[model samples]
Structure formats: structure tokens, C-alpha cells
Target: MAASVEHDSLESMEAPQTAVEVEETKTFKDLGVTDVLCEACDQLGWTKPTKIQIEAIPLALQGRDIIGLAETGSGKTGAFALPILNALLETPQRLFALVLTPTRELAFQISEQFEALGSSIGVQCAVIVGGIDSMSQSLALAKKPHIVIATPGRLIDHLENTKGFNLRALKYLVMDEADRILNMDFETEVDKILKVIPRDRKTFLFSATMTKKVQKLQRAALKNPVKCAVSSKYQTVEKLQQYYLFIPSKFKDTYLVYILNELAGNSFMIFCSTCNNTQRTALLLRNLGFTAIPLHGQMSQSKRLGSLNKFKAKARSILLATDVASRGLDIPHVDVVVNFDIPTHSKDYIHRVGRTARAGRSGKAITFVTQYDVELFQRIEHLIGKKLPVFPTQDDEVMMLTERVTEAQRFARMELREHGEKKKRSREDVGDNDDTEGAIGVRNKVAGGKMKKRKGR
Candidate 1:
């Protein structure tokens, strides 16, 4: 079952001049949402409106541009989806909305939520992201889906090359995770998109924090926007039990294995710092008989989605990922989040922990802090304005797993070397056939011939 949006007690961070206070108990209908969307919301098990939804939907329905600031899991999707679908109900058109996201997985997730919310209305969404065949994405764009969810780079690729495709008639523009988009340095691509789209469209900018870049974007894109902020400070939810494990750097993996065995039945999202580390950690865990999957930027788009779906379905007990999965993804049953690698940026720590303990559910987050990471970890604690208590562990039990863990690590390293060699050979075989300049045919050469038909949106 889908998790319902609950009322959060956090106050708005920085209310803009046009901001309006939303009552806690207001339903979707009370926020001036239409009946059809309300029914769709009910079907999705969103019985009560989240705080952002309650505050933003009414103004959005009134055709006001908005800047929504909230934590990752505070129902930001519902806040934007309802208003866009409702407007689609009134003004039926192809390419009605364009949602720009930072990552490919997030693009697909947003498309799923849009389709689920507007399923009765037959809302079609085309996801355009990198790491897949561009021809297929071009075809999806040619179909003229009701909403186009895309990353900046891939969308620009299509806009320049995909004939008969344009967003001149687009009515709504949503920049989900606006801060992350800027952080990833999509400013030029975003500018090009801004110039290409219609000037009189309704724009919504949603971000966890209002950074300087986001503010500049608001000035350039939005007109007299209303600010709807759900959280006034950087803080994790109360339901999340945050803790840290201080261990020697060499024994980090052993401590991770020990903790996983200690809390054996719970699902885990273990965050690594790099793609290679994520892959290696996943391989090591799998070799030790754990159902662990890796999701990182290096994998193909299909494989990434497969990993996410497998974890979501409980087919896998562990999800090993980089910061790519740290923001704006709503996976409801994540029982724990392990920071195997502490995030360098203090702000990212908040987003990483926000993945679990969502929607009124209790969860745990354990950060692995080594001697080298003390300064970074301290910065995180200071930023969050609270010191996390140490998570209890038995040193003898942790050391007991060291022998098996060392063996698994050796195996993982071997597998990684072989995988890297295979990729090198594949790329070398492709040689001149690779479209380096246009990004048209840069798919995984190993699976290039087995192009599967993508599921319909």
C-alpha cells in the first residue's frame, strides 16, 4: 500500500511576501482541488493533505507561480502533482507540463507519481534522461506525452536534435529539487530551456533549501511567486533514531557487516561515496550471502531502475548507492540508512538521513565515522544542531566477522577488475561507431543488441 501524506508540525522556513498559512487538517478538496484529482488522491491513499500540498495547491490552482521549500519526504510530489493535473483537467493539451529533475531515477520516480495520480485521466508522461538510447527517448517525445519529465542534459539533446519536438505550447514548468539541479551545474542547460519554453507559463520551483542559485532562478523564471516552506530549519524527523559508529577506518566494512547481522531483518540503504565503492560494497555483501544491489551513475538507466524496483519490492534486503539516491526519492519501507561513507557536504547529511523515517514511520540511521572523517562528521552535527549518540556494538562480535569479510572483500575486488576489463574491451570494440559528439549511441555495448521495449507510461 502507498504511504499516506501526514501533517507535519514543522513551520515554514522563510515565508515569502505572498505566502499563506495552511491549516493542518485541510483535505485536498478544501485546498480547492477539483473532484477528479481528489478521487485520484484517495485512490493513491493520500487521505489527508500534506502541509506543502495544503499551502501550495490552492494558490497554484489560482494560477499563481510558487516556490516551495520542504524536506525531501514531506509530500512535495503531491504538492505539485495535484495542481498540475487539475489544470490539465481544465486545459487539455499535449506537453502540458515539463518537470526538470536532477537525476534519471528521480525523473522516473516523478513520472510514476504523476501517472499514478492522474491514472484515471490517462495522463501520459515521457521520461527523458541520459544513460539510455536517445532514439527511444526521441520517439517518446514525438508521441507528445501530457507531461515530459527529464534531466537537463538529455532534454537539451532532444530539443536540439529531435525534429518536430518543442515545448512552445507547454503550460506548466516544474523544477523539482531546484537546488540539486543547480548544484549539478545545469545552469546553461536550464537557461537554454528557459529561453525555448513559453514565457507566460506557470512555473514552480521546489527545493529543500533556498540557496543563492535557487533565488536567482526564482528571479529569472517566476513572477510574484508564493513561497510555501514546511520546515524552518535543518532537522531530521523525530521518528528517525539517529546514531553514529566510531570505528577504525580499516574495520569499517566489518562494523557494517556486524551491524547488519545485529539488525538482521530490517531493510538497509548503505550510502557509499563513489560508484566503485558502491559496486564493490554490493559485491562484497552479495558474496557473503546478502541480497544487496548497487545503484550509481555508471550503471545503465534500465539497470538502475531495476535495482531501485527490486529494493522497493523487498526482493533485495540492501541497496548500496552513492549520493544519487540521497535526495527526493520516496521509498516507504526503508528500515535503516547506513552512511558507509560520510557525506562531504554537511547539507547532504540531512538529505541522506531524510530517506528513512518518512510518513510517520519509525526508522534508524547509523553513520560510520572514522578518524579521518571526524571534522566532516562534526560539521554535519553542527549543521543539524544536535550531536548524534553512538550506536551500541560489541567489538568481539564485530571482529568475529572480520575473517569472512576479508575473504569477501578479496572476491569483490576480483569481480570489479574483471567487470572493468570487460567494459574496456566492449568500448574498444565499439571504436569509431560510438557517437561521442551527439550522445545518440552511447549505450552499454554489452547489451546494445538486446534493446527491450520500455514499459508504457
Candidate 2:
């Protein structure tokens, strides 16, 4: 406890010094980034450094370990990537750096950023995560990539089992989303990983909030780190217009459809509390003729990545996701966010709403608050330091949606039950190939029952 307090004080005291120094540095080149990397940043359309990048890049270039505190969408990846790429340039070697992330999605996203930034230098990166074949990963490790981005559990699996592979000469280590990494209870695996990596390597820890677990991890991992905090307080971006809708739990789907129609032509992300709810709501929306998709922990990794790619490509306009998509995965063009279920924790409210209004763009967020979620909604309001205005709706117009939504709900439930049976049978007869293509075909066969739009809202 005493050490954590001392660490907090030290971080607070040193945070401002770097903030003051960052003002004079306007560009990545000004922050000691190499000419090649600056050009690569230009090609990627990053004209200027973000706040986190501006603060951490210069210090990292000077060979100092760093602890960065920044919110989601604050360009934390660039802050750590630039320094690691720069170091690799000066002293090029395979397996030069390792980044440990909390989720497979986040790990893949980081690898994409690294490859983009280091395109000119021919930097190779391997993503090691779960739900994928380990045999293929063994081949990737055999080829000796320059950087390895991974989750803790799978990385430990490789360290113990993979033949002729090690990180004894690694020069840099990064734990992105350090707080979430610890919160998911990967502490034992993380400890095991730390025991093997070289203590002389530089470590950079980036997290949204500083929890006790994160503070403890900082002491265990980083060495005399300089703290670079962009926003220590929990708050949403200025361009976000947040609102709430209070309705009965039974009428939740009706209100959701009304809102989607009201905000047509805009891309949306809807947050749900459970995987089952996410899948059910997605089927319901799809039956109503909306371009809806589901992303949850239960799906195969290829399907999960396919869902994200389809959403990003705008082939699908609505993504119904559990909290798995909430943190550290960047999809920059979201125009609105809907909290279909209010988060039990207030801090998640910030991250969910943060998905939109990103990078100085204007966006909206509407949260659905059922009677049972009053206390949760109030806690969210308290955390954000303001009461959300009610989203205007004509009760009669919403009521008109009830019959159509109810019909769609019936179809959705039927499809879900049939899909579950198919999955079970497939697992017994063959491998778990549970293809969504056949499921969608079935929906098309029953498309005659889908309700047509009622005129004159």
C-alpha cells in the first residue's frame, strides 16, 4: 500500500514535466522520430502527433522506460510503436520487441499499426493469440519475426512448448491496456512471462485508468519509468451528445428499432451485457431488414474478425457486441453508440461512449435505461458528472413499433433455437463448422413473413 501511494505521487509529480516539454514538439520529426518514420506517418495521413504520442515519444527516444496514462482513442499505440520502431532501426534484429495485449482483437490491431508504421523499414510482426491453430504460430515463430504481439496465456504456452524459440535478447516489452490485462486475471501468466524476459529490456505500460493492480504491475515490470499522462481524470470527449431513454424492459426492442429508424444512414455500435443477448438482438435486427451483425466471445475467431471487418467496411451498418469490442479496438468511423443495456460499472460507460466522437468528430450516444437499471443509470450519470437529457420520442410512434418488433422477436427466437440445435448436432457428427451461411439462407427462405414498413411516422 505504501509503495503504491509513493508510486502515485511520483507519477503525478513527473507527469507535468513531460507535458510542458511536449508543447515545443509539434511533429513526429520534432520529437526525434527518424525521417523514414515521419514519412510513413504522413502516408498513413497522421499529420501531427496526438497528445500521448507528443509526451511519450521524445522521452522514449532518449531510452527511458515510460508509464503512459491516456484514454481510449488517444493514440497510445503510436506513443509506444514509434520508440520501438526507432530502436529497431538503430539496432536491427529479429524478435526485437514484444507487446502483450489483453485480447486477441487488440493484439491484431497493434500488429497492423506496427506494420503500417514500419512499412518502409521492412519490419515483420507475428500475432500470437488463442482460438487459432498453434501449429501455424510455431511456423511464424520459426521464421523469427521482428516483433511479436500476443496475449499472456498463449504466449506462455509458446514459451514453454515451442521448440528453439525464446525472448532472451528482446530489447523492449510493452503491456498495452495494462489495467484490463490484470483485471482479466492473467496475473499468474504475466508473472511467469516476466520471469523469462530480460530485466535489462525497456518496458512501457499504457492503461486507461490507474488501478491498484496496474500500479502493482508497474512496480513489477517497468524500471524507474517516466510518467506521461494526457488525461488523468475520467471524462468523455466534447463533441459527444449523450442522451438516455427510459422505457419498460419488455418494450426495449421497440424503442431500439425506433431509434435506428430515427437515425438512418448513420453507422452504429450497440453494447449488450451478455453474449446471448448480443446474438439474440442481432438476429432480431436482421429479421427487421437492418444490416446487423453479432460479435461475442462464443464465436470462432475467424467469424469474430469477419464481423469486425464487415462493420469496418460498411457492409454492415449495425454491430451488436458484448464488452469484448468495448475497449482498445479502434473502428474510427462510428457515428453513434447505443447502450442497449446499461453497464453495471460506471467506468465502462466512458469507454463505450468513447467509441464514438473520436479524433474530434461529432457523434451521439443514446443509452436505454429500463426500470430495473435505474440505479445503474444513476451511477453512470454521477460518474460523468451530469444528467443526460431524455431522447425525445412520441409515445404513440414508439407504440406503433411494438407489433412489428414483437413479430421480429418471435422469428429471432425461433432462429436462435434452431441454430443451437444445429450447433450441437454438428459437434456430434463432425467438427464445429456451424456455418452462418446456411443459417442466413434459412432466414431468406422465411423472408416472406418479414413485416413491411408502416407509412407516415
- Highest-scoring model, lDDT: 2
- Which pairs of residues clash in candidate 2, taking residues 3 or more apart in a chain or in different chains? none
lDDT of 1 by residue, 277-343 (tens): 8888887887787888887766667777788889889999899988988887767788999999999
**Candidate 2 Cα misplacement greater than 4 A, ranges:** 1-23, 429-457
Instruction: Please provide, for model 2 over 1-457, each residue's C-alpha lDDT reduced to its tens digit, 9 standing for 90 to 100.
Output: 6546755775777666556766677789898999999999999999999988987898799887899999889999999999999999999999999999988889999999999999999999999987788899999999999999998988998999999999999999999999888878889989999999899999999999999999999999988787888875888888999999999999999999999999999999999998778888988998788988888766777777888999999999999888878999888789999999999889889989999999889999999999999999999988889989999999999999989999999988987776777656655765442222112111111112222321111
Q: Estimate each model's TM-score.
A: 0.90, 0.91
**Whole-model lDDT per candidate:** 0.84, 0.86
Model 1 CA deviation exceeding 4 Å by range: 1-25, 431-457
True-structure Cα RMSD, model 2 = 5.2
Q: Roughly what TM-score does model 1 have, to 2 decimal places?
A: 0.90
What is candidate 1's local distance difference test score? 0.84
